[model samples]
Target: MAHEGKADEQLFQLLANLLHQVESLTNQEEVELRTKIEALGLEVTKVPSKSLKQLDELEIAKELDKLSEKLDNVDEMISSAMAADPQVQSLLSDTADIWMPVITASADERRNFTPSVGENSETEANCES
Candidate 1:
């Protein structure tokens, strides 16, 4: 049981490391995409200012809506790029392969682990007999 627990911990760590790598890769890709967009003369404002009190409510709302649309466009561009990038697709496939087995094993373990409710009851009953 102790060994099994250790193995599970190791698997969890591996999964966490893989996920972190994927996240880092995604952030890098997004930065690259933003750079490309900026290169094409579109201003990529990543951090929108929250100080909209100076503007009227309608103006603030309009600004927010505009920012949302810009973000959506950026996302669409990134999605299209990812779809065309074979390396990104391969990395995603490899990650899925590594992730699936661990997840399936965890689910199977959870399903199989049933606690015995009256495990000691039988011994006590035999002693009484």
Candidate 2:
């Protein structure tokens, strides 16, 4: 039971870490992209995940999921935003190649991740009991 809670906590921490990484790349790299992302309403930070309640964990999970959907459609968003505003098109053209790939790769890695063998075994044992 405790392990399950720990696992949930770990999942929340991982989601928050992803959020922080996105912020770090966008925050320092391109203000334009940052502006686009900030409009999505993510409030994640460097909070210590261990101290948060389970409900907070659920909220973080939902927010991260929401952010992922928008991120997955980034190219389309860029295209539409660029079409709508010529100024942003020029700005995006300058830096879109710089940090977007890193963010995408990070998201891919997160999506394709498999839990460690030990973690799976532990979870299985917990379930069997």
Candidate 3:
């Protein structure tokens, strides 16, 4: 169906944009944090600590592994819960089917939601000005 295709396209774009925006914001935050760290005189090379560890590639890989393990635990918990209760399983299934569209719709709604546009005449006048 054309409607389903359009919805799928919107969902895909939403996910892609989300990933891009998150990465961009995360990079900005990393830059700010690094600046703060440098200001604090805690540069990795300057700091003298016996237990100091640089976040190198291997460390990042290990962290990724831990993240994967945590996700697996989450999946296991979900599967276990679904197995324990048919009603939960059904509800989850329904949520998966219904919430996807609701998520897109709610996102659109929030994006359109405006402030300083109520029935208050003074507030509307200030906003317009």
Candidate 4:
């Protein structure tokens, strides 16, 4: 039982690290998306072409879907980490209070900007028991 507890601790730490990485990657992707949008906006303002502009819009939509998937994975990691310990569950609850709205807003903003976008197909699966 003692060894099992130690293993659980290690697992929790691993989950935390993984969640942090996912958060970082998601943030980086958001920045990249914003940059692409700005660049495309500039192009549209300067030399607006339907084909190029439409392709850029499609790319942005795809990137947004990818971002949504990444955020879902981060949420799943947090949920799994919290399940490992009561303390972690409480901590995650607090963190979610701060983070969940921002992630949801980000997704909503993307959808609002791109009305002709496709829905995301990323589903979170539980692998840890």
Candidate 5:
């Protein structure tokens, strides 16, 4: 009977120690996860019951409709302004002439210009020196 009681006591102590270790590990993991989440610029918070509300779908739809109409009006105004501006018209008409040669020259130079890997490192070292 004495030996059985001693065995039970030892088993309980071992279980208690294991439980404590598991709880410590869990707490450490929770702290690390919270720190990582905070570092990511995200808010980790609980919402209050009073602050939580269902979305008003009808209101959202109405607001989106109003926004769409406003955007269309703005687009029309921009088109009218562009049509009225001679400089804008000239730029639109001459876009290829103004941009094509410069773009083509850059592309041709890039195709021809292959620098050795060591060349870049040497240039960087020289600049640092």
Candidate 6:
């Protein structure tokens, strides 16, 4: 009935909102990571060309590796959020699966009962008097 449809709409809206939130979080993380990488690149570019010692360069590279690991963690978190978000959608999907057929059959029955304007309405009016 109307109630079930309303419930479905609410569920769909909730799931959609959650998905959008996760997407926004991912975008924010990407922007933040890009900024970090650009800043690090600028810093590395400032290093003196004369003192190109392997050990110092390796240490700087290790710092970049740490940043990379942090990015990986952010990615994992986003993946986890996405994975969990599906549970809400799955429930809504289940509701649709069980109720959609019944709603369709009821709608069909209602359509069948509706009289066409020309013949049936006139016949029914004649019978009523």
lDDT for every model? 0.50, 0.50, 0.46, 0.44, 0.43, 0.48
Cα RMSD, each candidate: 18.2, 14.9, 18.4, 18.4, 29.2, 23.4
Against the hidden true structure, what lDDT does model 6 obtain? 0.48
Tell me how many clashing residue pairs each candidate has.
0, 0, 0, 0, 0, 0
Cα shift from native, residue 38, model 2 (Å): 5.3
lDDT score for residue 60 of model 2: 84
Rank all candidate structures by their lDDT, best first, as comma-separated numbers. Answer: 2, 1, 6, 3, 4, 5
Q: Candidate 6 residues 82-121, lDDT tens each?
A: 4766753453354453334433455444334422367435
Q: Model 6 compared with the native: what TM-score? A: 0.27
The CA lDDT at 115 in model 6 is: 26
TM-scores of the models, in the order given: 0.33, 0.32, 0.35, 0.34, 0.28, 0.27
TM-score of 5: 0.28
Candidate 5 colliding pairs: none
Answer with 3 or 4, whichever has the higher TM-score: 3
Tell me model 3's lDDT, rounded to 2 decimals.
Answer: 0.46
**Which candidate number maximizes TM-score?**
3
Worst 10 residues of 2 by lDDT: 39-48
Off by over 4 Å in 4: 1-55, 95-129
Model 1 lDDT tens row, 50-108? 98468988997998899789768856874775597765566546545433453456545
lDDT of 1 at 18: 39
Candidate 5 positional error at 76, Å: 1.2
| Full-model lDDT, candidate 2 | 0.50
Per-residue lDDT value at 80 in model 5: 69
